[model samples]
Structures are given as structure tokens and as C-alpha cells.
Target chain A: MNIFAPVGRAFFTLLAQIGRLTMFLVEVVSSCFRPPIYWYHIGQQMMRIGYFSLPVVGLTAFFTGGALALQIYLGGNRYGAEAIVPQIVVLGITRELGPVIAGLMVAGRVAAAIAAEIGTMRVTEQIDALTTLATNPIKYLVVPRLIAAVVTMPILVAIGDSIGVMGGYIVSTQSLGFSSGIYLKNTLDFMKNEDVISGLYKAAAFGFIIALMGCYNGFNSKGGAQGVGAATTNAVVTASILILAANYFLTSILFAK
Target chain B: MTTPKIELRGVKKRFGPKVVLDGIDLVINPGESLVVIGGSGTGKSVTIKCVLGILRPDEGKIFVDGEEVTHINGRARDKVLRKFGMLFQGAALFDSLTVWENVAFGLIQGRGMGRRQARDIAVEKLAKVGLGSEVINLSPSELSGGMQKRVGLARAIAADPDIIFFDEPTTGLDPIMADIINDLIVDTVKDVGATTLSITHDMASARKIADRIAMLYKGKIIWHGPVSEIDNSGNPYVDQFIHGRAEGPIKMEVRG
Candidate 1:
């Protein structure tokens, strides 16, 4: 009983955290439909969460695409199948690596940023000040970030998908002795619209997870500087983990056939 | 008799096992300033938070202008909040915004006023607090502590709210600046004709701004009276606190 007690407590704590996150999500989503959408704030957040994240997301995708092509070429050489590198690279980048890498990178960059900013506001009584000013903090802060993330993530993933395929193309043509026209033809012929759409859907879900985790941790942050730092760490960690987990589930459901 | 501007009846609040407010019953009349004075961690801030709906009381009833508002939510809560303004202890001005924008935030964001009109009103409010046009475009971080408090005061009064709250209005300023802030609070409250509730341990700030004083000790109101009567309130806790005496019925918890 004594040993089970710790397990029971930990289980309940996890349940409590899940419950809190769910409620926070419901509130933010509901606020989206209400009046006072704060179009200005949504635009600002889109610039921050989407535009500012482009360089990092693009660079990561490019590198991952190059590495994936290299790995597939080397692995396929043993089977005399190196000619399939372009096809494999395009399929993998568009379907998996592009959205996942972009999500992870943005989760590290944007989630930590959102958490630190909102957590500082929380500790310094700015959030309470918002309340007294007849403003809802969730509506004022969280909804805009959520909306911007949901809207811009698909765009980012789309761009990253193109850049990633370009990365594989460059590697295959310049280093692997494959002709540019043939590699391009293979990639174009192998890629499907459903693959791209599925990845975009995954990007949107990851964006929601990133913003939601950031805002939830930030809103619940307490103490002072240390509390905010902890919130930032927690936000990135939770978002990254959730993105991977959600990817697996989404992939299973979307590609069940 | 006129209905009290604000009233708390058996308002109790606790955090976990630690009770911060122990069944407080208080009233603030219309157009009067009431200051609650106590040492740190005496639940003075919590009392104000309860009234503001920033922190809900565990057990209580709170009323504003004779309307019960303890458990209201959503639009009703925002409707109630429209009548209030607050100056936080840290003078929590939004550091991201320019000084005038900080002052105009509640106006532009809460009431949806046009930006140009809100900026004009913000500048006027700043001038009322003795801030000139030169400081309008600067960020809150660029201002001195006293200037920040002035900007905070300007923001608090910008909406012309019916009730204003001052949380440690003179916490970090030098004696001269504290006095200046006190004078500003007095002038602004009078100008707006708003009932005010303030909490502080600064006796000078209390004496200068409060029409009436309440002494909170151990989460309860130990003594309350008009400012004229605070010095002679006769309760040992009140006597010890107001006079700044270390040795009396009050005991300081020196853990070290």
C-alpha cells in the first residue's frame, strides 16, 4: 500500500495536469468565436510565430532532406537500388521529416518564447492588471497566438516541404552523380497531393500543441524568475513530446488504409 | 443611510492549508478613501484581490454599489470590472508599450476607443500626473521608479472608474517621491470622485491619503477607525503598528 501510494499520487497529478490543459484549450478555442478577435494582435503573432520561425524551420528541413537522401542512397546501394534515392527522399520529406522537423524547431523557438513572455507578465501582475482593466487575459493573449499558429503552420510546412525536396534534389544532382532533370522528374512523379495535405494537417495540429503548451505553462507559472524559466523548459519539452506523439497517432489514422 | 460603495461580509480566503484572509467584514462608503495597513504577508493584498475578482474568496459575499458580485463570470464580471482601476505594488506598467500607450491601453483595448483619441486622453492624463509630453513615447523601463508610479497612476485614472485600488502605492520610492505619489493619489482620487481602497505598511502614505484606516493582523481586521482616531485606537496591535514599535502585543516572526 505504501509503495502504491506514490504511484497513485503521481497518476492523479498527471490526470490533473491533463484536465487543466484540456480546460485551457476549450477556453481559448471558445474565445476565438467571441467578439473582439484582436486582428492586430493576431497579425503580430503570425509575424512572430510564423515569419520569424521561417529561417530556422527552413534550415532544419534542408539539412534533414540532405541527410535523408544520403542515408537512403547508401542503404539502397547494397541492394543495387541507389536509383530510388530521389523517390524515397521526396516521399519521406513531404510526408514526415518536413512537418516533424519544422514542428520540433518551432516548438523549441516559439514555445520557449511564448512561455517566457507570458510567464513574466504573470509574475509581474500584468495579467491581473489586464483583468482589472475589464479584459480577459486568455482572449487578449492566448487566442491570438493560437489563431496565428493554426493559420501559419500549414504555410510554413508547405514551404519547408518544397525546400526539403529541393535540398534532396541539390544533394542528389551535385554530389550523388544523379542528373538534375531525372531527379526532379522522379520527385515530381512520386509525390502525391494527399501526402502533402496530410503533412499540412499534421503541421496545424503541431502548431496548436506548441501554442497551447506554451500558454498553459505560462499562465500557470508562479514564483519569480525561476518559475518563468521552469515554465519555458516545460513548454518546449511538453510541446516536442506532444508533437511526436500526435504525429504517430495522426499518421495511423490518416494512413490507416 | 446610503448604500456603501463596497462591502465585504464574512469574506474568507485561504491558500492550501494557510489561511490568508480570515472572515473579513469591511465597508467603504461612497467617495471616501479607506486604507488597510499591516506588515507584509498580512493578507492586505489578498483582500484587495478578492474584491477585484482576481482571486476569488473561499467563503464570502462581496458587493459593489449594493449589488452582490461574488461569483459572477464572463460578461457580467467584465461589466463589474469596468467600474474599477488599480495601481499595483510594482507599478506594473506594460513594459512593451510606450508610456502613452500604456496609459491608453484600457481605453483602446477594453473600451475600443480610436487610437488617436485614446492617445490624446492618455497624454492629458499623464499631464494631470505631472508627466510632460517628452516621456510619452518612451518605454516604461526607461522611466525612474517615481516616474513609473506616475505613469501607473495616470493609467489607473485614465478610464475615470468609479472605484480605484492602490496596492502599496508608495512601496519603493524615496521619502520625497513617496510623499509626491501620496499627494498625486489624493488629488487624482478627488478629481475622479472615485471611492478608493488602498493597502500599505507605509504610515506616512496612510496618514497622507486615508480618510479612514483599518489595521489587519493575522488575516483579520484588528482595528479600524477614521484617520484622526488611528493614533488613539487603543488596541495594542494598532498602537504597536501605527507607532512602529517593535516591543508590544504584536510579535514579529524572526525565523532566522
Candidate 2:
């Protein structure tokens, strides 16, 4: 009977995990304001999490945009609504695909890196060393990373949104035999600032979520390399799920009608 | 005659069915160097972690300087932690930071000291550990195991803390390097007059550095006494561990 209770326990565990995430956010915010700001460490964190993450985010968006263009143009000819292809590609790439796909890729890359790096530090006592020096690890390690993700993810997303939209345009005009002038006009006419803004907001939130999940799992990691591996895997999976869920919530709020 | 700097009472920790740190009780006098000796995975590290609040024990209490530290928080916890300096099992210096930066990590980040002042102190601390200023700009990865330990030692004494912890400080170093580290430990502790607790599997390192020694077995301190009495501690577990014998009352937990 006890062995069969995993299903029930899992549900409660999920509830508990969400609670922990909320607690983590609050704890981090509270600690952020306290003394002992580690600016240099923050810069180092920005380098690791933000600057190093551009390549993966860029590639994911470009490919996704290119694929979207091909799919939309192919489907449009069935109803002779070929003019709608450009508009659809722009709207889809900017609003949904860009942020979501970029997020998933960065989440996989950044979250796992943060987790493994911090998890190793946790076991090796670097985190403890900070404490003994009277330096707060939450400030030195977690806060800088959280701040970096919050700031960088939006930038990555903005670039991703443009690149993704361009990817679709390239495929439509060059590969799929569409007139460049007409395709560009349709894309411009249908796109709005609100759509891009919403995507950036989502990207920022997703970045925070990625760093948060990674640092939380990493800081709490135990048992050495095996613990680091588990944290990395968990960060990717959890960040992906959370991004999707947050996307739904953001969309509903942004377009209530 | 000095007060006990670290005191643990009935400290017990367990992970699911696995019991670790079963009712560990000990007291370390101020300015004394104490070594905890045991085979690998015998809860020596767990005992130290319990004292540091890294892992909370399922039962028991820990106190530092007559103040209960196991459950304190906020500025109080921060204040308590300021008294400690630890050299991790590995040096654990930040790969992201230079050697001087790693050594000055606490002074600059924790205490909010100015960069120039912290750097000066970091340089001085490095010199104390026999590392020249030339080594300061290099990252920790550039250093060998022995040099890294020296950097770790520099970081530990950088803040001149009241207590210092060394976790397997000499495990990976060669015998000569191990002796050098022990000598550094002795000299540094003498210079700072800080209480020290270390966990090690190496008897020669323990013998060279410890003023007192304790042997951990089956999750408790099986024997504790002045360093001079370790050979005659009259505990077979201590005997087997220090002597490095294959057969004893202790059995390995091998799956084979």
C-alpha cells in the first residue's frame, strides 16, 4: 500500500515545489536589498548566463522562423489564401514561436549550466566558504544570477523575435518563390508593437524562471556529480513546463477579449 | 583555560534509512587545532556541516561562543558565521575570480570593503601563505593541487576569523606537499590565534597539525583525546583506522 502511494505523493510534491518556488523568489528578493552586494560576482554571472547564451538562442529562433514560413506557405495554397502567409508568419513568429522556442533552448542550455556549476560549488564547499568569509551566498551567487537572467533574457528574446521573423521572410521570398515586396508589406501591416512587447515580457519572465530554477536546484544539490546531473536535467524540464504555463497566463491577461 | 569555541551535543543526522552523525558530542578549545579522523563516508564531514548549518541535524544542538547557532537566522546568523573560515575539501576557489579576488572574496563582498583595500589585504594574505603577488592575478585552475590548497588557506585567513575549518585539506597533495600544508596550518593558526577543526583520512597530516584528535566511527566519536595519546587511545576502531589495517572490528560496506 505504501509503495503504491507514489501517485498521491507526487501530486502533493508538485504543490510543495510550487510553494518552494514562491518562497525562493521571496527569499531572493528580500536578500537582494540587504548589505554585501557582490558587483564583481554579478558581472561574472552575467558573463556566464547572459553573454554566453546568445548563440543557442539565435540559432533556435532562426530555424524555427524558417520552418514556420515553409509550413504557413505550404498550407496557404490549399485555399488560395497565399497572401495570408506573410501576415501569419510574422504574427506567429513574434507572438508565440520566438519567445517559446528561444526560451526552451536557452532553458536547456543556461539552466543546466547554472545548476551544474552551482551544484559543484555546493558540494565542494565554495558556497560555504563565502559564508565563512561573512559573504552571503544568496547575495554573491543567487542574486547576481537572477538579476542577470532577468536583464538578459529580454535582450535575447528581442533579437530572437526579429531573427525568427526574418527567418520566415527569407524562406518565403527566396526558397518558396514569393515576391519580397508583397511579403514584406503584409508582414508589416499585420504586426503591432503590442505583440512584440508581450513576447519580450514573456522572454524576461522565462529568463528569470530559468535562472531561478537552476540556482535553486543547484544550491540545494547533494551527493556530488550525480546530484549535479539531476539538477541539470530537472532545470531544463521544469523551466520548459513553467514557460508554457506562464505563456498561457500572460496571453490570457494581455488579450482578455 | 580558554572557553570552548565550538561545542556539539548529541548531534544526529539521517538520510531516509541511513543514519549519519549519530549523537556527536565534542568541544574544541579556543586557539586549539583539532583533527577528526575517520575512513571515508564515516560522517566526519557531516559533523562539520552540522556545526556550520549547511545540513540541519535531525536531532541535537550546536553552540559557538556560548551562543546557540543551530537555529539562528538573519543578522545573528551572519554574525555567527563571520567567526569562521573554511578551506574546502578541494580549494573550491571561484573559477570566475582571480586568486587575489578569491582570497579577498569575504572582505570585499561580505564586509562591503573597498576594492583597493581588499586587494591590499588579499595580497598580504597570499604572502602569509607563501604565495607571491605574481600568483594573485592567476585563476585557481592555473594552480596545482598543492598551490590551490595554499590559495584556499590564504582565503581562510583573509578575514582573520575566530574559527577555521579545514576539510580534507591534504587529501590530494603529495606527502611533501601535505607536510607543507600542515606546517602552514600550524603557522597560520598560531599567527591568527583561531580555533581550528579539520577532518582527514591522512594520519601523518593529523599528527603533524593537531593539538587534539578524535576518531569518528559508526556515526559517533569512538575516541577523543590530546594528540599525544592518539596512538594509545585504547580504541580498536581508531587503532585500525590510523594503522591502515585491512581487517578490524570495522567492515567495509562493499556491494560485492
Top candidate by TM-score: 1
DockQ of each: 0.86, 0.66
Worst 10 residues of 1 chain B by lDDT: B247-256
lDDT per residue for candidate 2 within A1-257, as digits (tens), equals 58759988899998988898789889898988886566766888778777787888788888888998888777888888766878888888778888888889888888988899889888877887776676678887899888888888888888888888888888888888889998888888889999888888888899889989999899878887898889889888988999999999988987788
Whole-model alpha-carbon lDDT for candidate 2: 0.87
Query: What lDDT score is found at residue B167 in candidate 2?
Result: 94
Name the runs in model 1 displaced over 4 angstroms.
B253-256
lDDT of 1 at A94: 80
Q: Which candidate leads the pack in lDDT?
A: 1
Please give, for residues B11-67, the per-residue lDDT of candidate 2 as tens digits.
Answer: 999987999888999999887899999988899888887888777888998989878
Clash pairs, candidate 2, are: none
TM-score of each model, paired residue for residue: 0.98, 0.91
For residues A18-53, could you state the per-residue lDDT of candidate 1 as single tens digits?
898888888888999998888989999999999999
